[model samples]
Target: MRILQTDPDDARFAAWCGVWAASQRADRPDELPRPAREHVALGRRLVEPGGSMAGTHRAAVAGDAVVGALRLLLPVRDNTAVAYVDLAVHPDARRRGVGSALLEEAGRIAAAAGRTAMVAEVDEPVPDPPGRAFARHHGWTCDLQESRRDLALPVDEDRLSALETEARAAGEDYEVLTWRDRTPDALAEDRALLGRRMSTDAPSGDVPVEEEHWDVARIREDEAAHLARGRTVLTGGAVRDGRLVAYSELHVPLEEPERAHQGATLVLREHRGHRLGARVKVAVLRELAATLPQVRRISTYNAESNRPMVAVNEALGFRRSGGLSTWSRRI
Candidate 1:
């Protein structure tokens, strides 16, 4: 079987990969975005900056038909740090050698760039037997556990109000804000400060939080990109004395047109005990309900060991969906 690599923007390769992905997902019990096209679009945007040490892409055409594929995201922080990998195999190609070939290629690409590690993630509610087996066979070790949670739709107003009151009484402050096309200049600055404290408070494995900071220009560009796809980003922050301490972002997946996903929530180190993390999250949910009335469900995830976050999500009426274990191997 011959292997071919293509830029995510290559139309012919993308169409072939999309066709294969559609056929495979036809039998699944749960819903997921069609793989190949979604990944291709992701890859294109990630690789646009010039002199980016990392590579961005999608791959297909192992041997005969386009049976399986993978997307590789190079790191933005450490030049030598191997980046994220996203893979999918056509249903009919399961148990075949296609996946193995693709993974071997991934290792080669990493090794060529002197990278020692690669990271991957999968959503809950998806069966991952083949993926689990591939990692094991390749000597990749499972290192971290992430838990996914889903918030009920048409949020219970009385229950949400009670939670907010309890959090406030505990010395925390909460506010939810929504914007049209751009995040306010002041909020963007707060995001930078909040980003600096994430590693200290959030669950992180051997991977270091790359010190790459986001400025207004960067955040603005990202917002425009999201809006271009018909999605909306709403920010919820916890503040004291006009200073932003903790924040969370909720994203509506407009392309899919049905579900909304909680992006990322963080609380600074000095503000941990007051339940600001949970308060900000629930606040985001309330904002989404008010703004986008058509959303069906909202989902978010945290490391399985993050009992604090888990407890807060549960308090806000989000149920445990399932867990995903992140696996990695050195090239």
Candidate 2:
């Protein structure tokens, strides 16, 4: 077997995408099978090297067939010590050393880039998933465990209204504002601040990550990347004393509006307990229902130890769907 760097534009990338899509479907029963073309779209949109995050895609090939694929992400600005990886091995080709070969290559790439640790996540429907066991066999430790939750959409209008009313009672002093695509210039700085806070304030549970660096430029860069990937970013923020103190965001794929991925939802340390978290989330969902009623589900993951946020999600009718765990090892 030989391993090669595969550019998204390379014809060989379709082979990698096939492996990725098949592996995802086989391992993650909760997720529907997305066409390899969607995977291609994701690969082609890798952020440029030297940006906040740089990435590379690698494929493991035996003769004419690809058996495994890996995407390595190196954060350039912060969390510089770790390389985040997403790896997949075709079910038909597992246990034949393809995964081990790709893993070694990934480590070499991370080391060459001066990284000291590696992190990867998996969808674990059960506690002892094969993926977790494989990580353990390789001396990696599961550092963060999160509960994956899903809220079926077309939420009952009455229940949503009641949630909004209750949240408003606690957040009466704050202003909730939302925007699509681009954040307004007046709130860019505050949004960036909140983004940085999300890195630190969120329950990390020993995950070897540091506060991510964020600024207006980084925010704009991310937005541009989202647009490049054909995604619509919906953001809602809570403003207090003319500055954003809390926020929530969602990314909806323009081509597939049936589901949306929830991003960060944060309330500044000083701004906690006001239900601003719920208020902002509710606002975003309200806008989603009004504008994108085709969206049938919203999915989010939260550190299992974060009961407060978990409670907020439950209150909004999100139910546990599966599990998400991050495993890491010193490179």
Candidate 3:
């Protein structure tokens, strides 16, 4: 097998996406399958504005066909010693060394870039799925476990109203506000602060993610990238003393109108305990239901150990759909 670096627009990239889509279906059947265009858009974003990392794509070719693909993400500003690698092997090509060959090439690329460790995630409905088994066999240790949850849209109105009332009572000192697609100029700075807080306040378990630095420019760049991919962003926040103290965002992808994604819900440490998390989340869900009636499901992931966040989600009618296991190994 030979590994060749390829562009995302290459004709062979579609074959790589086929492998990825098949793998996702086998691993997490309940989730929406990403199309080839989404993968292409992701590739473009990885190398574009406000991206803190550089991405490399490699395809494993055996004889005349592509059987596997690997993407290596190397941080450009922080965690420079680490590389994130994702590998997908065609179902028909498994057990033929396709995955191993791709992983080996990924290792070489990471080492050449001075990376000391590599990380990847495996999705499983249970703890001992084939993907986890493969990662263990390859000497990668499970570093973190995230529970993926989905909320069916148009939630029971009475239950939702009760929860909203409870949250409002708890956050009597705070007021909720919302916007679509872009951050309002009045709240842009505070929104940036909350975005940065999201990285530092959330539970990371054993994952080695660094605190992300955010500002108004970075926020606008992120919004632009989402728009470029034909996705709409909805944001809701809790304000106290004219400053954003808690926030949540929902992303609706144009390619899949029936599905949405809960991006982040964060309440500043000092503002925690007032049910602001639940308030912001419920506010966004209500707005989404009213504005984007076609969205039937919204998915979000939380570290299993994040009990407070998990409780908030459960209170908002989210159910456990699957789990993600992150594995890491030293190069």
Candidate 4:
């Protein structure tokens, strides 16, 4: 078996998608498979190599068939000391050393880039999954466990409306604002500030996370990337004293309209007691339901220890779907 560095061009990209889809189908058939076009768009981003995020892709091949693939992401700005790795091996090729070969290459590449630690995540419906075992055998520690939840759409309209009414009353002093696609110019600065706060406020469990600084330019870059992937972004925020204090976002994929992904939902420390978290989340869910009626489910992941956010999600009718274990190893 030979491992080769691969570009995300037409042929290699197709092979990469095949490997990833096959692996996920075998391991987690209940989850939605990532859209191929989204993979291509992300490949373009990874290949550019000059932004806050950059990555290298490697493929493990046996003769003419690509059996496994690995991606190593290095943050160009904050968290420069760490690298993220994702590995996928086709089900047909597992236990034949394909995954091991790919991981070895990833570690070599990450270490060469001056990264001190390498992090990876494995989704497990139960503890001691194959992926977890593999990581453990390689001397990786499970540092964090994240709870994954999903809310089936067409939520009881009457109940949701009633809850929204209560939340609105609780946050009577704050005004709620909603927007789609892009952040409004008037609220961009406040939104940027909130984005920075999200990095520090959210629970990270035992996983090391650096606070990411955000500005208008970075916000625009993120918006552009989402647009390129043909995804719709819906945002809801609470404003007090003409300043944005809390926000929630939902992403609907054009390629897979039946599913949506929940982004960050954060309320400033000074603004927490007013039920703004629940208010903003409910507002955005309503907005998404109205604007993207085809979305049947929305999925989100929260740190297992984040009880407050977990309560908010539970109150919004989300049910536990699965869990992920974040693993790390020193290189």
Clashing pairs in 4: none
Query: TM-score for model 4?
Result: 0.96
Candidates ranked, most accurate by lDDT first = 2, 4, 3, 1
lDDT of 1 at 311: 84
lDDT of 4: 0.86
Number of the top candidate by TM-score? 4
Q: Report the poorest 10 consecutive residues by lDDT, candidate 3.
A: 45-54
Candidate 3 per-residue C-alpha lDDT over 20-67 given as tens digits, one digit per residue, 9 for 90 to 100:
888777766776677677778768877775586688899888886888
lDDT digits (tens) for residues 1-331 of candidate 1: 6667766556457655664456446544465655454555555566667423347444557555676676676766433476677777777667778778877787787777677787776443556655676777878777676777887688788988899888877763445444544667777787776765564566766542355545555566667666755677877887787677788888876667467777768888777798787677767777777778788777887886788888888888888777666777766
Residues 1-331, candidate 4, lDDT per residue (tens digit)? Answer: 8888776674676787788889888877876777767767776777664567888788888888989978788888688888999899999999988888888888889899999899999977665678998999899988888988999998888878877888888879999989998898888999999999998888776666688878887888789888888898999999999898999999989978898999999999988888898888888988888888999999899986788899888888999987888999888
- Candidates 2 and 3 compared: the better one by TM-score is 2
TM-score for each of the candidates: 0.87, 0.95, 0.94, 0.96
Instruction: Give the candidate order by descending TM-score.
Output: 4, 2, 3, 1
Q: What is the lDDT of residue 318 in candidate 1?
A: 86
Q: Clashing residue pairs, candidate 3?
A: none
Per-residue lDDT of model 2, residues 117-233, tens digit only: 999997777667778877887899889999999999988888888989998998789999899999999999999999999999998887899999999999998888788777899
